[model samples]
Target: MAEVATSASSSANSSARSVSLLVVVDPVARRLDGESVRIAKDVLSAGASHTKVCLPDDPEEFARALGRRGSRRPVVIGDDSALLRAVALLHRRRELAGCALSVVPVGSALGLARSLGLPTGAVAAARAVLDGAERRLDLLVDDSDGVVLGTVGIPPVPAPVPVRAEAGSGPQGAASVRPWLRTCQSLVRTLASSRTARTAVAPGTPGPARLRVEVDGVTLVDLDQPVEGVSVTPGAAGVAVVEVRPLSVGAQASPLTASGRTVTVSGAHFRYRADAVVSGPVGTRTWVAREGAWGLTLPAE
Candidate 1:
């Protein structure tokens, strides 16, 4: 009996220490200081039996690195954008639901990751990748074949896409050094204030936009009424909670709310932010909720 117990214990230890990991570090994560990323690498390496590391700079390289993952579990090291890219790639291949994904959040935009119950600290998130539970989570898929693991809001607040540009172009270009547009706007605001003796517009004040919002084919709001914004959030039981808040202040009626598997919005040209990406200026778009569409490894209990 004692010999049998010892053999079982040894087998369990070996299984625990022999986890194979394909650790793909995003370029953005590498661009940051080495301390956080170094800590994550050291932790994963110490725990896993075999760890293959890849530093992918762009979407193509990122996909290729993941494609060559073989049989090892994939552990992504980056912020929310990096995580979303991995999910998007897997979903495009129709392999997201079947594959368990882990994340080690390591960038400035980690709200989505932390909101999904991932560990915030590097060491904790990395360790969770090894000793965590794989939970099947819900996601929103749009008509355009895009996926959203977080909130989707109309009025088009898009996250920055990861792309490389020349030394003086893209987001860090010389043109971005000063807020020239903002300064001009401030001057205009001051002149308008002097002429009209009124304060500048407060934030959250809506502009005149109208939309027809429908959930499960039921119209919640029509174009007759002006709207400030419309939004959809993941809710219980594979349903998305849809709302259209009246942008106008005087017509303070209750915001229209509905929950359904499908939410559609149509009207004047509009765009929506899905996860980290901003989608179209289309006339209309519909999003469908899929239950257990993907798997995310998070801290146990």
Candidate 2:
């Protein structure tokens, strides 16, 4: 009888103290910085009671690995895109509510992770994964079933062009042109084209999009006014902060701002940048803030 009681107590204690983790190392992250990935893996393996490491070579494999995590705490060692992919997968599976995620920021693009207050250093981030607190965070879900952890930007930002000219184009063995000179040339060309491109119908070159912006069923900006851009960010208490900037006429008009749980934008096709990804030329879209919808592990304050 005493032996049985002792075994029961020992089993209970072991179960209570056990920590199992699933570490997913993104391929891009490994290619970008193998050392950081190694450090993160080492730290997490040593700290966790049991750790299962997975090196996914592609996005499909990455999704499959995370989907099979089972009951283990999922830890991602990758960049902003990888983290977003992981969150998106879980959200799609309807498992976010029950899963708390940890990340060791390892890619060149760490802006989103930094904005979320995640540790950037591999060692620190991994340590936090081992000994950290889970905090519920707000999420923005769009009509198309996309999730945004940070801000949504309208008229998506353009990608940077390569400064160096392609080889074999310049004179044989000629030295490469200076990047600043190329930038100035590009700017001059853009300005010249803009002037020529302006028409009587549209005052500005690359005319502003006519979008209807609504917040919580209240119309803030209509199609009558051309807007330069629109931005939406998830705020506390299940609200989203929205802003619509009108195209500058003779004098710049102050942006229209509102706060609501739902934000809808519709009109001529337009593209938007959500966190790091640029998506769609959709005619309409809506986003709602889900406060405390998901959990993330961060360093304890």
Please give, for residues 1-301, the per-residue lDDT of candidate 1 as tens digits. Answer: 0000011133344655667888888887776534787798878877777777887778788899887777888999998989999999999998897789999998778989988999989989988998898999888898889888989887755344332223454333223324665566668866854654342222222365788989999899899988878889888779999888886566566887889999998987766677667666788988999988889999999
On TM-score, the leading prediction is: 2
Q: Which ten residues in a row have the lowest lDDT in candidate 1?
A: 1-10
Per-model TM values vs. the true structure: 0.79, 0.80
Which runs in model 1 stand beyond 4 Å of their true positions?
1-16, 158-206, 249-251
Per-residue accuracy of model 2 over 1-301 as CA lDDT, tens digit each? 0000011133344543258888888987876677888898877766666778888888988988899888889999998999999999999999998999999999778889999999999899998997889999998999988999999988776444334443454533134666888878799868865765564222222447899999999999999999888999989988999999999999979998999999999997777889878887788999999999899999999
**Local distance difference test scores for all models:** 0.78, 0.82
Relative to the unseen true structure, what is the C-alpha lDDT of residue 276 in candidate 1, on a scale of 0 to 100?
Answer: 69
After superposition, the stretches of candidate 2 with alpha carbons farther than 4 Å from their true spots are: 1-17, 159-207
User: What's the alpha carbon RMSD for model 2?
Assistant: 9.2
- lDDT, residue 135, candidate 1: 92
